[model samples]
Target: MAAEKSLHEYDVILVGAGISGINFAYRLQERNPELSFCILEGRHELGGTWSLFKYPGIRSDSDLYTFGFPWRPWEEQNSIAQGARIINYMKESAAMYGIDKKIQYHHQVNNANYSTSSKRWTLDVTANGSEQRAFRCKFFLMCTGYYDYKEPLKAIIPGIEDFEGTVAHPQFWPEDMDYTDKNVVIVGSGATAITLLPNLAPKASHVTILQRSPSYVMSQPSEDKLELLIRRMTWWSKPLEHRLIRWKWLLVPFLFTRFAYTFPKTCRKLFGKAIQAQLPPTLPRDPHFNPSYDPFEQRVCFCPDGDFYECLRSGKGSVQTGVIEKVTPHGIKLTSGDELHPDIIVTATGLKVRFAGGMKLSIDDKPYNVAEKFIWKGVMLEDLPNAAFVIGYVDASWTLGADATAQLMCRMMKQMRKEHVVEVVPRRSEAEKRTMTEEPLLRLTSTYVRKAKDMLPKAGSSGQWKARSYYYKDIWMAWFGDIRSGLEWVRGV
Candidate 1:
């Protein structure tokens, strides 16, 4: 093992050296090898999302063909991979790139205060057994990920807390917790519910899904021939290949998403028919399970390990398509007067998203407010100087955008250094133009919406800037666009 150094700080201070943070570090280092930096990660190891969440059947919902990195071919042939496999890949990347040494394990940064006078940031981080230490640096980059830490959750069920049975959240299931032979009730119908029910089916005596509303579930081939073909072609311009793929998907869903938003019922019928064909003909009819929504409105869940749909074919479990009225001491009571008693309850209700809340950046004695910032090209946050955040793709594999953000950040940094500049931000007018141009795709409200609110660059007075939401357009703007021609470094220019 390389001897770890405890220098006061580096030229850059990165939060969460997961995929985004680690990639950013490498990109910056590649641009300026003389640059010194350190990454502060909350988890004991790397692999941000992959390492933190350890629930059963945990794997990426997105396909690996598009989500996986360009340089390294996914060792796994499958389109989607298991959680453990992905986490290991992350660790492997760190080792391959010598990034592990730059990482400070157990260093959890609570907040950062930026000093314009000194051109540094004082980071308050917890490390070495919760002892808080402050580190100062010239620049701050946050990639802590969007999801908040696991906390106690609440349900709408009446008298639910009184239940004598064990309660667990799929988000933070204990390492030693056992589900075998227990009757479990999974509440909520998002990705977690879709995944948990099947994994618990074999061990649990009975598993019932209680939900208020059902998300549209769409299935795709576990593998894509086009993606396989393209994986070989990624070595070319990363931006070029991404554009080809983005527009390729746009052809099918381009009209569907627009039609769904304009004429909701028509699009819903298209999805309903698809669901009906896959479901059992003899099962009872329930709209909660079969909704009238666009296929990809919310991300669809897939069981890569086993047949996800097969869980329904067998009698091991059932889906209760009704709203939960309340929770009694024993179990959950539905609004339809159906009471489900169980030995354990798992809450898979979706996650709570707080835009800009996760990142606390204080600059020049003033807090950098996300609400006031406009999203530029769906990447950089406005009003922030020498700072960037790498967000994984919501609908696509995070690595798809993860790779793009890394490349673009490095390119911009190189340009800044060459031109001699201290800070750079998107012009408000340009950001507004981009946002307004793509409001339909960039509606500032999806699970990925908070990112736009916090980081989207500001545009013009119209307040409708077009943010290039697609990966291809963003790469061009970030890499090729001459927007930064106006920027002249305050020091040397």
Candidate 2:
């Protein structure tokens, strides 16, 4: 017979140990010192995405200045960092804040049920593999990121299984796999594929980026030159300089996004010109560099120091635009009768969207489908009590949105404590259901987003339930927005 599971309780429980969860832990601890909390991490390590992904030249597409925690700013000169460095940075932050001790590893939350009678959440967790455990908390916070950790978005390449050459996915990269002097073909035009091209080209005989259509590829420096100039100003302290650099990164991306949306044609022309400047005279900007969508419609892939283009210019890597008719035993066959017989094929297709880490939720024995519901304030779900999840911005550094949400959550928790409220739920009226049109909270037209449209949360046209905007506006709303207007607070049992 199996042993009875142990029961533990806390005032608050965090469901991840990633950047969002670690940041939230700091805010929760600093803002509400009296409240007891614990972080339950499914993985053995702390860095969620950074710790999980292990591929050649895996690094942050976003600059590390804003991607790093706001509390402990990134001190490194390189704004673009590798996955291992990011993991170590996060570890240092957790240790410095003593958040490391509060983490419980190998604790996977499979199901969470909120009881109205008890006004508490009971989480059914699997710890250390098979042993079941139970945890009860007044508030539940999900920092589990949007993508599925266990599965990558399945690339529907016909006859992929028949390929005699080694096939791999960037999500689950095989360690120590050698491709020395071997021709390699990477499928997709996203960040992963772009990153792999330059990284693998030096070692491989040649590399080819196979894509159905091109995405905007921009060149970014690993180190910020403007930051160096700012640091040279002796009037400012190191901390002040760091803050200035951070703000510079934040505003630059924000302004770029605004410009791209406001003047897409102009931005597109500029992007094309920049790309053309890097490409050889032989390779025109028509089919490979030119994108079907405007800039910022989908994410623009950034390569550090024009490395991707440099590889192309050096004749080490190349880009092929076409549809994959089938994967033959030798390699890939294009719909246009061209075939690539590479030694290795890498499917750098996108990620599969997964919410709440795929944990099931229920309230008073009634199942709550997150997909069918609407998100309130980009943090809390409608009709879900004492629960909040972090969803970061697609355009800017994810940490910016996460920290903003943390501040908002802290404010809500403080208000609840001040009023002796046990349960707080975001309640929307029937008029909202009828009048407000449904919109996708993830405002991207990317293939991955389009494929999982039915699974994401709904956004309203206006008001508190409207779709999430840019970081600056969201941060403002977080600090001073309406919190009690559409909320129902229960004080006592």
Candidate 3:
């Protein structure tokens, strides 16, 4: 007979150990100190994207004040921080809260089975790509982020194999590789490509950013002047100064989004002027800086202190806009019949967005398709019992949504324990389903989001069933609102 598998039990199983995971764990332990919880990390270490991505000039696209957790004030002067600093910050947060001790590294959850009868989840986790283990938990919280770990969204160009040059993806950048004096061409005009231009240009023989279409690009200082001023004020306490700076930075993004949506033409003019002001007089602002879509429709790329533009102006970098016809032994050939030669090509293409960390989910041995379900307030899925997944905002800093979701999850779990309930599920009535409209979970117009829309959950038309992206609205609903909305509390099964 085969040996029986040992099952470890816990009150909650928090997935990923990234920013969302650490934040959620911190909130749970802070609110309910007696609750037993463990964090499951797929990778050997923490830091999520910050740790995973080691590409040139990898940094948070959003300002650090908003990107950092609300509980922890970012003391760094640079609003746009390097990847290593962010990773250390996350490590420090985990260590300070004792969250690192609770993390089980290399424990990647492959499948989760929920039993309605027992009101428990049986997780099949693979330890370091082998050695399967079983973990039973009363509540499951998935903070695996929005993208796939193993695969990135790489475009299949014709004759890609014909290229003799070194090709790489930004997602899994080779650590030992060096491009000190080699000519480099980075594909895709998204955040990665934009960031790589300035950083690589200084060292590389020449750096060229090739894109099929343009994306909105703006420049801002690395440091926040207002935060610097606040920090310098000796009369103000550190905590008070931090809170004020955080709120101030938070309002900027919110207002920017509001203005863009409310007055598209006006915002477009303002954005166009900003781009033109940054670029040199020789570089035409038409096709290079001006994007096809309106502002805020897609994410705007930020270049700290016009670093990208400075590289271009200084003749160290260039931008090319054309469709890729094929890749030659020398370099890339454009559809417009323009041939360019480069020593190295980097595919800075977008991520492959995956929901629930691509883990197979089943309810009582029946396979459950999460895409068919409706999202409840962007946290819980309709009719999904004792589980919540973090889906952050596309418009603003992701941590804002993450913090809100964590607060809500803690509140709901506490309410369940207080009421002596074994299960708390957000179920939509048949009438509610018929009356409510369905929409994609993510509203962003980015390529990655568009590709993954079919695989993600849907949002309802109104009430608690709808998923919201606004941080201000979420603050009220998740932080201070009642947990009874659209949730069913049941006694012991």
Candidate 4:
């Protein structure tokens, strides 16, 4: 009863106080200052993944210029920054914009029921994992990230329990745990595993990266040379230099991705040569660096200043490619009959993809499975009313798409206010739904994505219904495009 009295209400309820949530709040505040909104965060703090993951070498795989919010330029010299720096940046943004005051920490939304008649959402929120309270909002903005934060997806190799040493996942790295002068084996070859290599290699006695298959890996410097040159020149102002650098960062990746898709063989050869140039002369370039798939089929792992290669070259780390037979008391046994005797094992296996942060949803008291719905313009769902979710670009920096979605949502809200519309929903025609190509929402070929294909929404053939990965096109379509197309407008419903 006391919890019921504590029930809150707002014009809009934003779930998750992460990067996307912060961006949305800023944009919405800038556009419509009269709107009253509150952000609900499940954790005790903000920063989302940056604050949650405290692994040895946690860092941003994408450059900061594109990954950062477009409204606020990342002024740091390092494009690929460490996790602590990112967390700090997010905190600074929240503080500077006074967004921190609007966030209710430790309030996790357990369920949401949207009533069409009232055109409002009633959320059952669990506070501090015990007290239950209700919240009502006119509109819902889901800024919850794509993956499950509670648990990481760990492959169950045989006899993992038999290992006597400490086995950990990067998602839940213990703060007090020490790995100095110990043999470490990290499982998986994704960005997390690659990031951990260089950082742990220097401290640990030896670090071995075990992968079932290789991922396309590339290395670039932490600082952008072009950006540095622009900064050095006095001809341009700071704003102009920032825009130039941001566009350069954005276009380079976009063009490279297109080139990889257009001429995969040539890009693959170039990728191999780049890897070979950094590797030690004794190590063969065939199985170690060469992956079975084409470049850009999956996201490429970027190492800052070739730190991973330098660590390997220094004889502190090594890479082994094979299937895991089982885990023994001492270490992991490979299918090729090779046994790795390590004191500590870090499972850097992928994340468990969760939609809408695993919040149960119902529209007009009817159950709704988000996976069964289709994505409209990569922002809102096909039939969801007064709600939008932020899903970023899979091919490029996530914030590029996230920023675009935020801007689009703000625009739609403004339009709705002006039109006196009580409810807005994207509706797919029966013909469009029946004839639409039921492709996986994500276009990447990563293992985690493949595993979560069925859990994700479907993409349509073309036009507004299609899920696009290109930031350039999404910027024009989502930011500048009309909001009336494919949307059903209800006036004072």
Candidate 5:
């Protein structure tokens, strides 16, 4: 048996040392000097997804210009960054903030139980489960992330169990699995498969990507002149530097939304013109990539590495439009009666989501599950008090949103402390209101806004929680919105 260690407690417990957790800890420490924190990370290292994915062309889907911390923006001058650089960025963040000590590595959380009577939580965790440790904290932030865990996939067709030369998920790619000269079949088209197609096509004999349906893809120069000019600005006030870049790209949308009510046609034309410029008419082929939906509907795919285009031009890559019929011993059979022999198959499928660290939450033991609840102020949950989780725009720079969330969380915590309120929960609604309000929130002008209502933490049908998707409006909201207006309080016992 391993030697027993002393128990510990803290004012706040953050799970996962990834972008969200690390940022939260940093902001919390800065905002509240007296509060104690302990961060529990399952992985041995700092970078979460960045460390986990080692596939050939692994990288961030969003441009690092705004995706990284506001104070430490990516000055690499590339819109889309490689997996390695992202990991390095995380390391720099940990070191710069002195967050290493707060992180208890190899501590995998099994279950965390909350006790409202005591207004604290007991986190039952084990490292490799050979030994266990218990930690108590007044507040818990679930930064395990919506996509931390990998999804399970079956052949869906017959005979996949035996004939497969090599099959794996992109998240769990083996270290020694050689793809050189091997025919590789990558399934799915979300971000992972799109990334793998270009990276693997060169090394492998050939790469065939199977897409159930078409997703919009945009190709930009991997390195742009504008990006080169930005790196020199990183050491300066980084947030201001990042904010300038964010506002620059954000202007077209801002103008469109700001005057859209009065000048819808002109605003629309400006955006349309921008799109037309990028996909110049001189080039042939359908502009499915241009997308019929308005911007920010589903987040646009970013492939600045130019690998996607390079592979297609070289004829080493093929992007098929359709679903899979089944996986044969040797290869995949498409619905179109096409059979592609692949030496290896990778399922880059989507993720399954749960709420609040996937932990069973109880407020005074009322049994809280945030998955189905309405969000308030894009942070707090209804029927739960003294609690909130980070859920940002799935289509934008996630860390940008996360940074704002960390700052907002600090403010909320301060309110709780100042008022001596022990808890804050949202009021439940009747069945008459089953979906989001038809009138969209001002900040959330994106049509993709509709896609996340099930999970977004909105402030209310109005107020900050009303659910706005516009970045500027949210920047305004996060900075100036009356965050405490909707907070229903419970007196401490």
Candidate 6:
């Protein structure tokens, strides 16, 4: 007979050890200390995205002030931080809070099933390599982020197999591979491609960014002088100074996002002028710098202190706007009769969206289809019991949204215990469902988001079902908003 699998029990089971997971862990410890929980991480180590992405010049586009957790202020002088530094910060924070000890690395949750009768979640997880383990919990939290780690979004580059040169994806950048003096061409105009241009340009013989369309690229300083001055003020306490600086970053981006949405034309002109000022005079701002879409329609890419533009000025890097006709053995041929001869090709295309870490979810024997469900206040999913997932903002710092979700999750858990409730789920009445039209969960019109539209959860027109992006609104909702709007609470199992 086969050996029986050992079952471990907990009050809550959190998946993934990324920023969202760590923040949630901290909040849980602070607010719901009585409840027992452990984080199940699939990788050998923590740091999720920061740890996984090993690409050259891997850094955050958002300033560290907002990106860093609210509980722990990023003390570094620079706002935009390198991946290694970010990883170190996360590791240090985890260790400081004793959250690292709660993490069980190499535990990949394959499937999760909720029993309505028992009011518990049973997860089928693979520990280490092939050892099977069972973990049961009252609550399940997925912090796996929105994208797939195993596979990147496959770009449709014709004749890619025919290319004789090396092709690399930013998601899994080869560590030992050297690009020394080889010509490189990076595909896609997203943040990843924009970041790679300046980073690879210095060492490569030449680096060219090949994009079918343009995106808004803005330059900001890595370190804020005003923030530095504020830090020097002896009158203000350390925490007070940090709070003030954080608020400045938070409000500035919030206002700017609203402004972009409200006045697209004005923002466009401002962005165009800024781009023209940094770029070389000879380079035309029309085809390469000009985007058909309005500002923040898609995410605006940021380069610290005009590094991307500086590379262009130095002639070490350049941008080409055209459709890829095909990939030759030697290089890429464009539809516009232009050809790029590069020794290395980097497909910085995009990431593939994977909900709940691509784990199979079910309720009592029925399969849970995420695409058919509507998100509740961007936290819980409709009909998904005692569970929540964290999704961050596309326009602002991701930590702001993650922290809001964490606070809301902790509050809900506390309320559940206070009210003596065994289970809670977001429920939509049939009447309400009839009036609600489905919208995309992700607000962005980017290629990856568009491709995964049908695969993601649905959003409602308004009320508790709308997919939220504004950090101020989300934080307020977490702290003071009513949690019982559409949520159903059960007294006993």
Residue pair clashes in candidate 4: none
Show pairs that collide, candidate 6. none
**What does the lDDT come to for candidate 5?**
0.67
Instruction: Write down the TM-score for model 5.
Output: 0.82
What C-alpha lDDT does candidate 1 achieve relative to the native structure?
0.65
The full ranking of all candidates by lDDT, starting with the best, is 6, 2, 4, 3, 5, 1
Task: For candidate 4, write residues 1-493 as lDDT tens digits.
Answer: 8756877889999999999999999988999788999999999999999999999879998999888878888987788999999989899988998999999999999999999888999999999999888999988999999999997886878899999999989999988878999999999999999999999988899999999999888998987677678778835588887888888898888899999999999999999999999888777787878998998778899999999999989999999999999999998999899999999999999999998899999998898888788888888887889999998877788888788888888888888899899899999877786777876688888888988877777788865788776877777875678788778999983
Kindly list the per-residue Cα lDDT of model 1 for residues 1-493, writing each as its tens digit. 1112332677777788677777777777676676688888777888876776777778777665455555554545476677898878877877888888899888777677777666567777778766767787766677766566654334455666788888887668888988899999888877777777778899989887776667766666654677567657875666655655554443444454556667867767776776666666655446655654455566655555345556766877777778777777877777789888888988776555443326467777677776566554456666666666666654555765666776776776666677766566444555444644323323333333443444433432333234445565556665676545323234432
- lDDT by residue (342-405, candidate 5, tens digit) is 8988877654443444556665556665545656666666666556677555546677667777
TM-score of each: 0.83, 0.98, 0.97, 0.97, 0.82, 0.98
Question: Backbone clash tally for model 6?
Answer: 0
* Candidate 6 structure lDDT: 0.92
lDDT string for model 2 (385-416, tens) is 99999988888889998999999989999999
Which digits, one per residue and each the tens of the lDDT, describe model 3 over residues 267-382?
A: 99999998888787778888887888889788888888889899989989989999999998998999999988999999988999898789999999899898898988899887
Q: After superposing candidate 2, which stretches have Cα over 4 Å from the reference?
A: 1-5
What TM-score does candidate 3 reach?
Answer: 0.97
Question: Clash totals for all models, in order?
Answer: 33, 0, 1, 0, 19, 0
Better of 2 and 3 by lDDT: 2
Model 4 bad stretches (over 4 Å): 1-4
As for model 1, its CA RMSD to the true structure in angstroms is 5.3
